[model samples]
Target: MEAFLAYTLVVAALCSYANSQLVPAIVTFGDSTVDVGNNDYLQTVFKANHPPYGQDFSNQEPTGRFCNGKLATDITAETLGFTTYAPAYLSPQASGKNLLVGANFASAGSGYDDSTAALSHVIPLSQQLQYFKEYQTKLASVAGSENASSIIKETLYLIGAGNSDFLQNYYINPFLNKHYTVDEYSSYLISIFSNFVKSLYGLGARRIGATSLAPTGCLPLARTIFGQHERGCVSSFNTDAQQFNKKINAAASQLQNQLPGLKIVIFDIFKPIYDLVANPKKYGFVEATKGCCGTGTVETTFVLCNQKSGTCSNATDLHHSKEASDHVSLKQFDVLRYQQAGRSRFLNDTDKAVNSHRLLNISKIPRRRNGYEHQENNSKFLQDGTMNIN
Candidate 1:
């Protein structure tokens, strides 16, 4: 018993040491999935800082996050041991120590393609990068040169964009459809993504995680516009999204090879969201077709999901379609585990801590399917720290 106790103490010390060595900060960029009210400061109609939108968030006050509650990034910051939320880079609240913890430059309706953002008067990717440069200068003044450099190098960068490019620009705009086929358009976006990652690396960002496009064809807006005749998801659009995801995955590999001493991981949000939509009953979701807000059919942005819109008792039902409602079924805890697992994998090797990083671990990372889906092997989806780090 004494020997066992001694071994346990040693293990505890090692664990604590590892926790202490975690990335010092988190910086985010992207569209609505990670946007925490940067649009509120902008003049675009894509804003979401109103009642009912934050009915479920802390203090039940809308702070510009697109969702009714905390965004995935908000939860991610807390999981990383951050006591305070990272304020929007454009907000007055984003000053002093908040800049140290990190800042969010994401804008709703923004995407890899500038035209998409321009259509809605949102900040473009190029402009967001400029803000990041400005952030570096501010950070250096506050934390001093060396401390700011350390913060930039050791920070976890989360980026999620590209959805608006397809949903708002490519699919709806006849001009783009006339100029480029879906395959050609995807390649064009990948090129932009490649440049973005390279630019971030040049700015001293070492650890980066970029999210792939979600199943947009499954969104309520898509269904309303393209699938109204069939009254279902637009299969062609979903197919395009899958193709884009595949191209981005390849791009990530290429970026890792080209940029030395840089770590980039592409998080696969498509599969988990697709699974929820495909098998809603397996995930305890009853209404998979519509969101809990307004009509849940075509509601998005300021026009829909507003204070006057009818909200469901449970926000988890905020999927965009009956068949696609599974997209929003992803629990906050599930996403947190996936991110933690990715961080653990990348940070596992202390010797190469500053030199190398790992991508997502596909084998052990489990999706948040319903009880029925895991009935056969309850242990498979368990959130234990045993997830394989590849």
Candidate 2:
């Protein structure tokens, strides 16, 4: 908890420079990675409103986030000095004054491809945009047209997609895989992403940040299904993710150049997450190949990782007694917490660059190279004790 607090403090301090929040509001759209609770309202099988899902969240109440506690975006909210999260757009909480701080239009299984969301009966990217338009009307009603316009122009827009496009759609859907090769599929997604950003720009958004795809093959579900006899991170899947990231990053740059007064940043989530997965011990985790809930091998969505599913114990405590050690079954959230802990290790320099320049325009920020590539050469803590951002 100390580490978490210290991490939070660093972020708070970064955004708190000049005695104000970085932006007036934050509007988010994407999949489960950023979905707060919109899936709870939807009649979809891809929900996370159950036990062990939000065990570390406030009041231990599941809020439809596919994790044990606050998401990285939740921490982003705190860092920006928002007293409350941008309420899920479909929730009752997203009305009146709540609309002023933006709304989360993300769904649990949605992605850049509308068909990806269709597979799970969740809201598609196009529908989420329609909801965003509706939200603008609501905001105008509450905050007035002029203030609403200002907020719309200044709000930090965030989008996290691509993961579901690959994991939930391409991998399983034979039709998709049969048609497009990896590069072709990624290019297709980039086209969708480009259009999405352009649509947002047209809707009065100026500043946007989109998350790059994580090392998808390293995910427990992927490891189980596709890791083959070697039982390791699938290099093919990771390569696909890297290629997609390259395309998206290029697409973001092109979009920025095409759209006047637009500032776009492709947040490099892949490297940090991959680093954590590769070197779990450096980030205070004992397990990296499985999730915390259920069998931890293949369970990810609602039914598989549900109330009946067995969760791993927090057995990696320093106490190391029989009681403590017996509980050792490391999982995803264990790594997530420590990933948060380790962010402070290198985020300081990165945050400084972002804070010093325009907060939203972080495209040119030169990040430190923490050596996950050479992790085997050193102990858990690198000689410099810094986490690298790729």
Candidate 3:
């Protein structure tokens, strides 16, 4: 009996050691939903460079993130056992150590088409990819080709951009972008975006788990704009997202064939989102329409949503801040399809119910606190006292 117990303990130790060795570092690309802070490098107005953006973040300063708390990349990285995301590709603060973990190249308001739409202060899809290339070179310098490939192999390449293309082309900018109606547009986007996947595969990205667009109509921004403040989703935009996913599924199928030892996976966020809204008890959410901070024509993502100078300060308080319009509204295209299309979908205002006891149960050191920073200082330290956010 004693020997058997000892053998079991030995087996457990091996499992732990093997699990530790397999943890991989991811390098992310795409738009604001996953953008750690790349917009900080650009001069455009599409900046989220303020307090509230990251107020709830582990660091507690707008790291140029576009969510009340963690970005999709943050949650996904955490789920995959990564220590934490590497800084934005443009952050001068990033070091060799940081880059090896992962780097976010997403920018607010970016999309698949190079010339799809025009946003005053957003990164174009092509430019975001350029930054990705730069990150690859930098990683290569630090970890060498083999080590870099190892990191890339373990990383989950999440691409959450697309709706911005529609916003820039179909909605706000009346240029009739993409040359298709909503239904046709989704198909066109899928075709155009396939090349992007191909490009990443060529760059040594082996494992890709893309976030399929969610219900676009359900975004706060769409609700505000589509029906003059009516609640619920923008069916047209939502349909567009559905169509986009169908294409993504098809494209991933083709890309899988072309690449060797490569995998393309989809994070199915659409049906889940709709189901969450339709049946809040299952997901522990209520009030899916209004944003926590406030609402308006632009909803709660742009200037009004800032944790600093916006009407009501929530994302941050007693921290550095900015003025209205100073913070780039990530609320635009990111609101729902992006999962926010606000892209930061997993989190919702329902979490802040004043009297409702209902809450979404979770695991982690939440990246946000009145003053808290989120990260696995070391992956091995997970579940240790230091990792508890509050």
Candidate 4:
């Protein structure tokens, strides 16, 4: 833990220095992966602002983040030199100078599709966009219109969504399955993604970093639901996810060409997550199939992972699982480092490095806090190893 904190401090110092000359704020939009605490403000079953949810977070207090600690977005914000964590748009903390740092519009269970969000009573992409507009008004009121515009233009917009679209909606809904095939559904999602990016561009966003879909089929819930017979990852679900990821990547390329002054980069999460799941031992993960919370198979939202639930002592063991508790700890640090670098070439370089499976001497890091450990190791790796974020 001491080594982890030391690494965090070092990276924080470096990022702080770099951020003084680069990004001024970070605005995030997405599902639970980046949703800080917006779901807590909503009257929905999808909330994590309770005991056992933040067992490893600072002070071990539940802060509405689905994970036991900070989400990738939270760590990204810190890496960008924002001492203050981004507040949820609906939370009282998202006012005054706090608006200058930015606010999180992500909600647990949200996706590109509105119906998917409706199932979990989460804030849909459209509603989140409306909230973004509201946030602009509030920002303008706090800072002058000119300054607000500057912040909007310079802010690093991090977006991560669409997981729930497959996990909680399409795959489970036989009605939708009857209407759309996997390919059709993936294309449909790409259309929504394209429109969402265009809308953000219309809102004065320029530096946008969107994450591609992870290996959802490898999730514990996927294994339980679709792989129950075989006791393995659902290949069909993973194939769909890969297809969706490809479409999103293609859309990102086209959007970059079509939208002028838009700097959009799609971060590839599939490879890193799939690598961790497929080779858990290589990454020092003993349990990649299940989460640390309760049964770790199906514990998500309010029903599962509650205060009474039995949580694993180490939150880091969770992996590509579907339970909200299932999270890849390494992702938080690596993704944050990539975003903080603010370089387009970083994605390609990092993808190659991750695919090559280069070890980073991070085995000593604790599971729950491995994000920081990876961040620390990533800094060194990026400097001298195959990965180069600069």
Candidate 5:
């Protein structure tokens, strides 16, 4: 009987140790880049819960992720030693004990600006925050008040925005562009980003990370439409993205200075993703300017790339482009017949880097509370307790 009691105690101790996570919880907010499946429940066309989407994920099933496999955030979670992902806020799985692990409030086709999400009838950033608040209440009910307070305070919050603001809204919306210049629109978005962070801080979030925009001009669809005549990256669009990154960096610093205990960092995805696009050979990607689906030129969303759509024999070797602008306001094109297109890798190599903390640079970020400043080439933030805002 004594031996039996000892065995039970040992088992209980082991279980308790295993339950202790790196940061207690991970909360995410963003667009399709980090959206797991929130859009699946929404009546939006910006979903990826179909074939060829998750062809490389475990179980070979689409989980509404926009990637061929695990998203960057998914890999980040795994790196942090999480066995299960944070359930999407709208999914049925986000209940009971699952709330303790945290929740994903991202929706595909959403952005920093609510107008951007409205263009596609998707959940806006403001709505996602409201959902997060609801999740917090449910979490407190499940974990109790004191435990839930610790979880919310220590949770690593990640947010991604801005991509759809430019690609899906401002570029196409004449009214938006006519009212504000591109720089002015970017400033407006940054103001929104600032308020969003402040709101999260008010709700007990301390650590946050934001991701910078990828090389938008190099995306296959962007190249096809804007750079068709040149067969090169649209310098104008990339310049806009670079300018936006600069503004975000400045904004992050200002936020850190203002928010007493907040630890914020901007993950530099621009350089890493651009490296993959510019020097595909360095990363073993043969074609960087085209996608693996359909004609490899456009075809991003569901209506564009169905099972009938000709997909490359191996998506592992190819990249996927951003969503096609098939909004009802614009004239739509006839769906293309199946055609064998060349494959090129996207985010695959970067996932490995993220696991090792190589490409996730937190350069030029001022660590105010840490009493140090990040150099222009440091990746120290990954080891530290800074969360990313995308």
Candidate 6:
């Protein structure tokens, strides 16, 4: 599996370097919306640290991840050929050996603000970048400085964030509120992120992919908690998402112009996910409104999702263990607390759809040199962790 994953990474890197697709070594930043498990390291209570959260994952432990399965980062990594998970950079066991493999710096419940916007628990964008630096330094130390520098220069840097900034801080956050208006906030975030991207380039990141925020209004947590008893999603939230995405797209254009020779790209997570929600038929997804967990009651983010809790469906009643170390089999309910709450009736306007009116042309990107060429072309772009200093 590891070798297969590694091979996939090679291919994915080739494709991503093309600038039209995702690449290897996904370096993430942002909130629980995309956090892997940084919250597990922290003492904060705002986390998705329970079973059924990772029901689809191998270990099946909660581990503080904040998604039904893997988030967009995991899916992106899988496509790129990461043999297994992109290791958590902060994980003590990592010891920096996995630096070339890829790392996740995202924390659960985190946002653009120092304090969490909605859940009152999360790492801010600044901290996330700070951790990323630590990981890079550790890698430099382990890989004999020279090799580590080479690796960071060649590796693909992926960022998926900012929704928490808008939704939690600007829109619906209770404790930590927004200081700027939606337009001002979006500009502020993109501006900071623009500088942050330049910083990465300064630190030897030549390839980067920044994902725009998805439709927060359609997210289960947003729809339910901020609904004021309404079953459907809030429209204003989606509007914020659209505006934020437009800003990101614009910023990506500007950054690309500035970073010469570097392959910088933007992932349209908004369009893909929105399409899935709007026209489930286009994608193979059956449900998008709420997840298939809890008694259809908690939605897993706010409550436990356990089949043992009597909310699971009749199909696929298999058991798996909690921790990966112990291989003892447990009931399906014991691990994945997934429960089909039936098809969601609450949805955005089917008549007013983004995908229906839009035709996204497949953009082509230049594929970087494969591993062999990467080793050969170490001086031109992949030497001593130096970029944009050119």
Clashes of each: 6, 1, 20, 1, 17, 13
Q: What are the per-residue Cα lDDT tens digits for candidate 2 across 1-390?
A: 111232233333333332444788878888876788999998888787887567767878877776667765676676577899999999999999988888999997899888889898999888898899899999999999999999999887878778878988899887778755778778767767776777787788876766677788877667777777465888899999988877776776666556666766564455656776688786566876665555565454432366766677631111001112111212222323534565344333333222223324334312222211122232322333221222
Candidate 3, residue 328: the lDDT equals 22
149-228 per-residue lDDT for model 6 (tens digits): 77777676766567666654556543323333567556656656666676676667877655566667766556656766
| Model 2, position 89: C-alpha lDDT score | 93
Q: Write the per-residue lDDT of candidate 5 for residues 1-390, one digit (tens) a residue.
A: 111111122222222233533667878888877789999998888778887778777888988887666665565566467899999989999999998889999888899888888887889888888888898899999999899999999887888778878987888788777766788788777766877887787788876766767778877666777785676888888999988977887777667666666666564456655665788665444766676777666564432356656677544112233222111101111111101110112122222211211223333333422212222332321222221222
Off by over 4 Å in 6: 1-24, 117-121, 173-179, 228-230, 295-390
| Model 2 misplaced regions, further than 4 Å | 1-21, 299-304, 314-390
The alpha-carbon deviation from the true structure for residue 29 of candidate 4, after best TM-score superposition, in angstroms, is 0.9
Q: How do the residues 1-390 of candidate 4 rate in per-residue lDDT, one tens digit apiece? A: 111121232233223334545477777787877777888888888777777667778778988876666666655556556788878998999989988888889887888877888898989887888889999999999999999999898777777788788988889888677766778777766766777777777778876767777788887667766787565778888888878877887777766666666666565567667776788876556767775667776664333476665777655223322222223343433435644664343345333311212223322222212111112332312321112223
Each candidate: what lDDT? 0.65, 0.66, 0.53, 0.65, 0.65, 0.51
lDDT of 3 by residue, 1-390 (tens): 111111122222222323434346656666656667777888776666764566666667766776556654554455345676668777885668788877777776677655542454566666667777777778889999888877766565657667666654467654443333566556555655565666666666665656567566765556666756567677877777777766776666665555565555543356655664466454334444544454434534443365434534433211112221111222211222332122124323211211112223333222321112222333322222121112
Model 1 segments more than 4 A misplaced: 1-20, 298-303, 316-390
TM per candidate: 0.78, 0.77, 0.69, 0.78, 0.76, 0.68
Per-candidate Cα RMSD to the true structure, in Å, reads 13.7, 12.1, 16.8, 13.1, 14.3, 12.6
Model 3 TM-score?
0.69
Q: What TM-score does structure 5 among the candidates reach?
A: 0.76
Worst 10 residues of 2 by lDDT: 315-324
Judge candidate 6 at residue 390 and give its lDDT: 34
Which of 1 and 4 is ahead in lDDT? 4
- Clash pairs, model 4 backbone: 220-321
